[model samples]
Target: MNTQHEFKFLQYPRKNFVRNNWSNLNGRWRFLFDDEEVYTHPSQISQWPLEIEVPFAPECPASGIGDTGFHNRCWYQRTFQYSKNSKRVLLHFGAVDYQAKVWLNSHFLGSHEGGHTPFCFDITDILSESGEQILSVCADDDPLDLTKPRGKQDWQKDPHSIWYPRTTGIWQTVWFEEVSEIHIAKIRLAPQLERWEVGCEVFVEGPCFNGLQLKIKLSCEGKVLANDTYEVVHKEVHRRIALSDPGIDDYRNELLWSPEKPTLIQVHLELWKGETLLDSVYSYTALRSVAFSGDRFLLNGRPYYLRMVLDQGYWPETFLTPPNSEALRHDIELVKAAGFNGVRKHQKIEDPDFFYWADHLGLVVWEEMPSAYRFTHDSVERIVKEWAEVIDRDLGHPSIILWVPFNESWGVPDLAEKESHQHCVQALYHLTKTFDPTRPCIGNDGWESTATDLLGIHDYDDQPERLIKKYGSNHNIADILTRYRPGGRVLTVEGYPHGGQPIMITEFGGIAFVDRKGSDTWGYSAVQSSRELRNKYEKLMEAIHRIEIFCGFCYTQFTDTFQEANGLFRADRTPKFSLNSMARATRGAGYSRGELTSTPQPPPLPAPDTEI
Candidate 1:
């Protein structure tokens, strides 16, 4: 992170589950475009000509260098005081686009390939004892490369229909941390609802972890409820602490996390060597369970309907990167204020800070992977690697209940006809479950689902009666919809069957209302009056509510962005219609509420006629 205070970009520089002894490196940095990728250590050459803020890519206007054109390679250089100590120092990058190589004081550290996952390097050996050190980063990003995951980042010279400007290079916070020789490298908390215990997986890094014991204390409102100590011999250790332990009889009252009341259990972790404290860190977790029974999506053992919106996570100035931490929290608040229990993050793997805010604000999230435009061995390998990294980085957050590996078959287009494509989708579904069996994994959202726990589909039909006719029936699943849908596509592929999974209209109700007359804004169907918009919204939601099989519905968007003017709010976050009306229309009475139903009802009407 650059130490230039005046040029600091990130308001919340610290990463989630943070500790003290950390410094923010998000300020003015010397930047230069390297199209040919010639320079290994660009700092050694002449001074960089351009100055851009760290974490905001050059393509973004907030970066102070709004170069939206194609530049395959770029270098960032900054200097900060870092005195070497007995402990290890780690340099962390929240995320960098495509390929990133780091150098410390002219010494090469290493390179990371994924654009969406956080990566770090131990720079203890290369640090100076007392003086300043030069830190440099080189990123090579190709927007046109279909082999890598690019979610909503337009590859063309200009922002196209749906896709926006590309975000290249560092687009998230960067920081430095000081840790003990044997410190906690990573920790994962999985709440075992049935067992009434929280499973803790701790990964330590050092030459030796012998004689080390991990002491954990779970508390709420300054009162400790459960405490445990486990001896650790291996680098990776797994331990479980029962919430029903002694003195924890009221655990359910203060421990369970939900959208209405998000309660976080403070965790005080300590690493000791025979009574000597080796290291200590602070963390937090929430107890929650997400399951699917027949057509109902269960949250903590009961049916909970998910009222969600499609959040593209874009801003006028920052594009994919938010301008500040306040913006992240504001979005969550807006979702809740506008009567939404959750958000399907669309195709982007968002910053961990967003997830942190969601967890704190009690907003459920469907964590979806960014899509690759084409399907190939390279695309498959890259998507799998990046998605695995993303899962590993964010699986600890309780707000994230579902993992969506694909969206509308953006990459695997021939899933219905090609056998290999079906196999690929199935492979990804099983792969996600293998990593995290706790969360339901959606193989491909919307259509052509090979293997998925959640059956999500997209429909933008303007008429409410048509939607009611399409889904409200009691016949075979294949006969539910016989004609083409709003976008001229089948509801489900030919061979794939609804295998009793929880279903949702993950994308729908994109009612377009343009505020400006001359603007080129549009939606699925344009409405001229606010009253019409409200009536349409209510009618559509009423149709959705009548279908008991649907566990949830996600409207097209939260706000208007670029050419997509179908948001409930404008691009600047101003309400397009009355907030109360939108809340009433999209959220009809108890259907939109997150209230849990103890007894799951039977599925909705089975078959539908083709006409409205």
Candidate 2:
């Protein structure tokens, strides 16, 4: 299906899981900007007065070039039709904002500089056997580049405070992949639900790899359980496979995945030279894990509290790009119907169809890393090579399960007396545990923390008996920085030493709901009704549920992005308190700061391109 969107929008436009070829080079192109960054592609411009729209972002007004200032060069042209006969076409690019340069048919064909991962280019001898083929793209983007990661976008000209507009060129989805040069380049999937098993690395691409040959399956609804077959002999291949891998033993431990049951399993590899199959793909995974214990947050091993929220994956009209895929499954079923079992996607690196609708609707992502507010050496080599290709393209997503890699200290701000900013946050927390050593790798989230497994903090304290006397118990780190975090912001950065882990108040209650209307209605305490926003959100979740040394809390968002109004909805997502009173002030109520719970409300969730 080659989507050209004039707007009946339901397009996931390929975030991988292709079976029958693939095409969708989004719609209406031919645009021009070149604010002196000097034209480099689009066959050196030959009059394209402006049309914009492919994967929206001409500072999006559904991209008819709303031009919200900051230009920095741009050009995009389109024309497509391949009439298949592929040997290796491959031209995908589901992202492009910082630097991109391509031209096919006019032939230049390559240039990608990480605007949030996904990149490709093969052009198979610049194909031209039948009709149409033009495809051009040029983007440069630098809204005052702080060395490039540019998350909450905006660098002045309009949107402010926690940044907002400024995205250039193709903002995701522009495809054309019909591979067969011995395909399947990459698929990690570690899994292992405490050894029920599943390793599978696989990374092939043409010739040598000892005559190829690999197959694997692991179904769910169609039921084939698990199967295996290997012998690729090097192009990176690992293996494990085993739910009980011989015939799958009647649901052994029955398909586990959580946030209250997410399940998934389906994958299907295939590639062969010795048998002529050549290549195939269609993936899926989840058996979930997410560990950490002492201050607790287990998951398949039990505890699991994280009622998170921070979601800055914006979209008053596709800012960080996502207005489809059922508005990313209605923003993960409206954060699991306002009770939040997870979502800390804060500095934005979202849209893999929002981690496939948060792994098929159960939700629990954290996956942060999108900063670069300048710390030099090319912003730590563009944040460790685009945060290790966005954690190797979202490490087999079992709804993410945490891997922040620097937040609060925006881009290594004197990381506690800089030893090269604590060796660039301990080399992005040991390269995010050497690419997914089973999730949870904070290293720098909320406060000044250095190497962390989770000790995040950012207290906005609208008093709930002073957040129950500052985390109700253990107090070290200069009395948790001058008695319960008094703005000196310290959590653990003087040579990292709070090793009990799990402390997440990852940015506290932003409050603000006073009559909404924006000119930046801001937050961090504004309430003037909805019964004082449910009595200060049930007294700040009853002081993090009577302390017990706090295991989780993310709030400070989940809508109202754009001059951040302390959203608990309302930035056009209504609900200023009442998804069953904000899911009983965040799930399973009890310690009541008194008078509220009437429960019933649940209706208003429709307009995400309507349907339902």
User: Candidate 1 has which clashing residue pairs, if any?
Assistant: 1-25, 2-25, 473-605, 473-606, 473-607, 474-606, 474-607, 475-607
Every model's TM-score: 0.92, 0.36
Top candidate on lDDT is 1
Per-residue accuracy of model 2 over 193-310 as CA lDDT, tens digit each: 7787878888887767577778887776557777777788767678888776333534543677775657778777777778577777767786767888988889878787788888
- For TM-score, the strongest prediction is 1
RMSD of 2: 21.3
Candidate 1 weakest lDDT stretch, 10 residues:
603-612
Could you tell me which residue pairs clash in candidate 2? 510-524
